[model samples]
Target: MSSLAVRRISECFVKPQFSNQICNLTPWDIVMLSTNYIQKGLLFKKPATLIDEHHFIQNLLEKLKHSLSLTLFHFYPLSGRLVTHKTQNPPSYTVSIDCNNSDGARFIHATLDMTIADILSPFDVPPIVQSFFDHHKAVNHDGHTVPLLSIQVTELVDGVFIGCSMNHSVGDGTSYWNFFNTWSQIFQAQSQSENHEYDVPISRQPIHNRWFPHNCSPPISLPFKHHDEFIWRSETPLLRERFFHFSAESIAKLKAKANSESNTTKISAFQSLSALVWRSITRARSPPSDQKTTCRLAANNRSRMKPPVAEEYFGNCVHAVSAETTTGELLENGIGWAAWKLHVAVTDLNDRVVLEFLEGWLDSPFIIQMGRYFDPYSLLIGSSPRFNMYGCEFGMGKAVASRSGYANKFDGKVSSYPGREGGGSIDLEVCLSPQTMSALESDQEFMNAVTEFDPLLF
Candidate 1:
C-alpha cells in the first residue's frame, strides 16, 4: 500500500461507529470529508452576567447525579480493534466552574453579561482553562485514535460559564440536551429552597425491532453511522440568525400558506420557518445559468412519536427530513411551495419504516459504532424551540440566549418563548466557516431582507 493509503486507511478508524467506513482513502472519501466538514463555527453573542449564585452552581451538580452521572465510559482498545460497553451508561462529560476577580479603580465588581458574540470567541476564556477539556480527551484517548468524552467547567463570580469538548462519536444533540437540561435544572434547583423538577418517569422502554426496518441482519452496535460529506456547499453562501417578530396577520398568512392536508397534519411556526430557510439556502447557491441542487431539513422526534417522550428523557431523538429541488425551482416556487415540500418531508417522518429504524437504533448496544458510516454531507438543518434561557426557572434570572451544543456544524438550533426583556428575541448561536460567512454578510440585499421580515424595520 502507498503511504497515502496508510494515512487514509489508519485515520478511517477515527471512530469505531461505522463498520463500512472506507478501509482506505478513496476518491469518494476525499470529496465527502473536504466538502462537508470544511465549514467552521460562527460567533453568536448573548451577554449575561452571573449574580451571586455560588450555591446555585454547587447544588446543580449534586442533583445531576440523581438522574444522570458524569463518568468515563472506558472504550478498551484491544490490538487494533475497540470495544464499548453494551449499555446505556452515565455521561462521560464532567462540569466544573471558573472565575476571575478584576479589581482596578472602576468600583471593579460591576456585573458583565457575556453575549452570544463573547461565547464564540474562545479568547474571552483563556486557553489553559480551555485546555482542561484538551487534557480530558487527551488522557482518555490514551494514545489511541478513537473518540472519547472529557468535559471541563469554568465558574465566574458574577455567573457560571460552560465549556465542552466532547467526541462527536458518543452522541448528538438529543444526547447533549438530556445532559445539559439535567445540568441546567441542577443549577436551577439551587438559589431556591424547594426541590428541582426532573423529567417524568419512564413509562415504556421502546422495543428494538431490526427485522421490521430492514432485511434480517445482526443487531449493530452504538455509533452506527460514520460521518459522511456535507451533502451540499456553496463558495459564497452566507448564513446568519436575525430574530423575526411576525405580526398576527403575517403569521396567520404564513400559517395558511404553509397549511395543506398533505402537510404533516399541522404545519408549525418552526416548520414554516424551516421551509423559508430551505428556500433561502437552496437559492442562495444558484446553479450555473439554469441548474439547482437538492434541499433538506432536520426534525426532532421526541414528541413526534406516540407516547410522547417525557420532558426529561435524555438522548438523541431526532432524524433528518430531506427535500430535493433546484435553486431556481425552489425560490421560484416561492415560500408556500417550498413549505409544501418541507411538510411532505416532515410528514414522511411518521411512517412505520421510520419507527423501525429507530427501533434498531434504540436496541443497538453499540450505536456509536454504526454512525461511522452515516453520510456526512446530508443536510439536516434543525431547530429546538426548547432553547429557552429565561425558562430556566431553576433559580436566577433567565439566560441571555440558548443554542446548540456543537460549535461548528450545518445543523442549527433556535429557542423562543419569552425573555426578561419585554417581548425581546434572542440571537441563535451560529458557527459558520469564514469564507461562506464573509460571502453571506457581503450581500447587502440579504441584510436588508432580514429587516423586511421585521415589519418594525422602519
Candidate 2:
C-alpha cells in the first residue's frame, strides 16, 4: 500500500441565545479594527474579553503579557499567527467563556460557523483575519495548521447536541487525553492541587522545536488526494444515535485478552482498541484491491521528559501511528490478529521512528505544508484520563453531557466519552452525511452505532 505523511492543522453568533449582538459588524462591511495603541491583554479579559476596535487584533506579544499560560496554550508559533500592528478593523472575533449554573462541571460551549464564503488574497487583512480562524486549526500555533480540537452544539433528533472538531496537528488521541485531563482537573477544582497554579514549571529547559521534520523523508512522497479536501462538518435532519458501554473492568479484561492474543508480547488497551477500530473500519469498507490502507493514529510524547512538558505545554507534541494493511489480509486475520499488528506499529513509541518523526517536524518549517491532509475526523478511540467535563465551572451548572464534537462544514464526526452520568469508558458522538450514515446503519456488522462503540458492534 502507499502512504503519505500528514502535516498540521470558530465561533459563532446566535442572537436568540443571547441578547447581545453576535458581531458588532454587518455582513458585507469588513471590520475596520482600531489603530489605537492597545496594551497587551487589553483585548482579552478573564474568560474572554470584547473586541473594542474595528480593525485592531491583539498581537502575540499582548496575549502573552496578559496571560502567558493561556496565551501560550492558545497561541502557537506555527499555526497560530498574531497581528503585530494595530488595526482599525475590529478584532477578527471575540471569545466569551460563560456559565449559567453554579456547578463544578462546566463546558467551554461555543457556536462559531459564520463564514465569509470566498475572500481570497492575504493583503485583505480584515477579511483575511476573519477567515484565518476559518480553518479552525488544531495547533499551539505550529507553523502548520493542524490538530485542532473544539466542540460544537446543534439540534438533532428534536434535541440539541454538541460535536467536537480536532485538527490532526493539535494533538493525537493522547493529546486530547492530556488536554481533557487538564480540563477535568480544572473542573474538579483540582487546579491548585495539580500545580497548575498560574504556574510555569519550566521544568528542566525549553526544548527548541527545531528538531522534527515537517513530513516523512523523500521517496516517501506525501500521500492523499489534495490539501484542501477536508471532511467538512455537516449535520443531517435524521438523527441517528446509539451508545456503548466500556467499564474500566471490561477494558481491563479486554486488555488482557488482547495481550494474550498477541504472539510476541504485551500492549496497552489503547493499541488494542485502536486495532479494533481500524479493523472494523476496514472490514466495513473492504478495498477492491489488496492495496494497503492506512489508519493513521497520533502519538503524544508529553510526559516522557525527566520533567514532563508542563500540562501547560498546551502545544502540539504528537506524531502519527500508521496502521496499514490490505482488506484481504485483514479479513483473513480477523479483529484480534490485526490489532496485534497495530500493537507492533506503536508498541515501542519511544523508538527511533517516533523520535525522528518528532525531530523532523521541529527541524524545519515543513509542518505548514503538511497540516492540510487529514479529514473525516473521528476519535474512533480517544479518552480523557484526566479531564472532568462534568466538573468544569464557568460559573454555570456542571455540564450534564460534556460533548467534544460540533456541527459545521463536515459530513459527520465521531466523539467518544465516558457515559453521560459518571466516568470510566467514553461516549462516541457521530456527525456524518446521510449516505455514509445510512451505509453504516445498514451494514449489519456496524448497524445503528452512531450512539456508542461496542468492540463487538463492528
Candidate 3:
C-alpha cells in the first residue's frame, strides 16, 4: 500500500463519427478562451468481490474505450482541437474548433494501487491527492495549442477514478454533464450487451450555433487579448482546501430559516445553502466591519435565453452574478437577508439581461476584473445544485463521490456538487487561506451545519 503509484497503460484517440469541418466559437465561448478548463472527476468504491484483478481491469478498459468512441460519434466537437485564425480585416483572431479527426480526444489508461478509503477519508483533500489529475490538465498553455478535451481512467485497488478535462471555451457545465451522462448511458449499454439501446436521437444531440451579440448602441469588440494565466498563481498567502458535507436535513433547516423572513418569495435550497456558506465564510474571515465583501456565483443561462436555447446547446452558456455587501451587513442581516440578495440577483438574469451581458462582454472583455482568488473579500462559487453529479453511473456502480480537480488551487473558491446520497444534499469543496480555514474549523455555527461524510453510513 505504501508503494502505491500511477502507471500509464495505454494512450489512444477517440475520433468523432464525422470530421473535416470547422466550428466557430460563440461570443460566450470567446470570453472564456483565457479561463481555466473545467475538471469533473468521480471516485468509485471497489466492488465487494473480484474474481480476478487483471481480468476485471481489462474488461473495464475495453468497455470504457469502446463506449467513449461511440460517445464521440454524438459529441464530435470534444474530439476536435481548438485553433485560432487571424483575419486580415480588423486584425482580429477567431478561435474555432477544427474537427479534423486527426487530433481526436485523448484517452489515457492508468492504474494506481490506492484504496478509496485512503484518499476520501479525513475530509480535507491532501495536496498529493490532486496529483491524480496532474497528467491531463486542460489549460490553454500556448496561444492555441492543446487538445480540446482529455480523459483519464485510473484503476485503484478498491475502486476506479474517471476524470475528464474539457476546455471552457467549447463547453459549459450543462454540456459537461450532457457528455458525461450520455457517455455513462453508452458505457452501461455496452455492459448490458444486446438488452440496451444505443441510439441517441438527432433532436437530442447538441446544437452548436454560436450566440452572437444583437444590436447595441455601440458595436462590441469581436476578439480581445487576454492573458493566459490563472488568477491565484502569485498569491502571497498559503491556500488550504477542504470539503464540507451538508446533509439534506441540515439544508432543509437552513432553507426554512432563509424563507421565514420573506413572505412573498420562497428562497430555494441552493440560495439558502449558499447564503449560509457565504455568511459562515465571511464570519470566519473576520475582516474589518467596513470591508466590502462579495460572492460571485456562476449562473447558467441556457433556460434564461429568449425562447430558451435547445435542450442540448453546446458551448459556454454561463455568466457570473455577483452579490455584494459589507462584511458587517452580511453578518448582521442574517441568512435570510443574504439569501434574498442571492435569489434576486439570480432571478434578474432574464433573456434581456443575458443579451445585455453579451453586449457588455463585447464592449470590453476585460471590464470584469475577476481576480477574486487573491482578494480576501471575494468568494467565488462554482457549480450548481441541479446538476445530477452522483447519478453518473458508469457500469460498475454509482459513484461514491465526485469533485473538481481545479477547485483546490483557488483560494476562497467554493465548488458545489450533489451529495452522493442525494435528496437535495450538497458537498462543497471550499478553498481558503490557512488562517481563515482554521477559523472556520473552530466556528461552532458553521461546524454544526456540516455532517461528516461516510459511505458506509449510506
Which 10-residue window of candidate 3 scores lowest in summed lDDT?
Answer: 227-236
**Model 1 / residue 210 / CA error / Å:** 13
Task: Give the Cα RMSD of candidate 3.
Answer: 3.2
In model 3, state the lDDT of residue 427: 90
- Give candidate 1's root-mean-square deviation (CA, Å): 13.3
Whole-model Cα lDDT of every candidate shown, in order: 0.34, 0.34, 0.74
Candidate 1 structure quality by residue, lDDT tens digits, 241-357: 334333334444555666753344477655565565455433334345255354455466656666564443322345666777656676566566767777778888864645776
The candidate that achieves the highest lDDT relative to the unseen native structure: 3
Put the candidates in TM-score order, highest first: 3, 1, 2
lDDT of 1 at 444: 45
lDDT of 3 by residue, 1-458 (tens): 44556787887877766767677776677666545667778887666788888888788877788788788887877877766555557676456777873567778888886778777776577554554553233343221566677788888878889988887777898899888888887787677765433464333576776566555322233444534322222222467778888999999988888898765347898898889888888999888989998987899887888778775888888888889999989998878999999999989889888887676666665422234333777788888767877767876688987766652245688988888888888899888888889998988878989987886444
lDDT of 2 at 249: 54
Model 2: per-residue Cα lDDT over 1-458, one tens digit each: 01211111113211111121111111000111111100000001111232542122223222212222231232222122221122235422221111121111111222222221111111111211211222233222221222223233221111222233333332334333434334333333432344444343322222222222334332122222332322222223443333334555555555676677665457676555555555555554444546566655545555544334454443345444666666677667744676677777676565455556445533431323221333333223333333444443322234334323212212232334555345355444443444554554455533322233322111
Which residue pairs clash within candidate 3?
A: 46-158
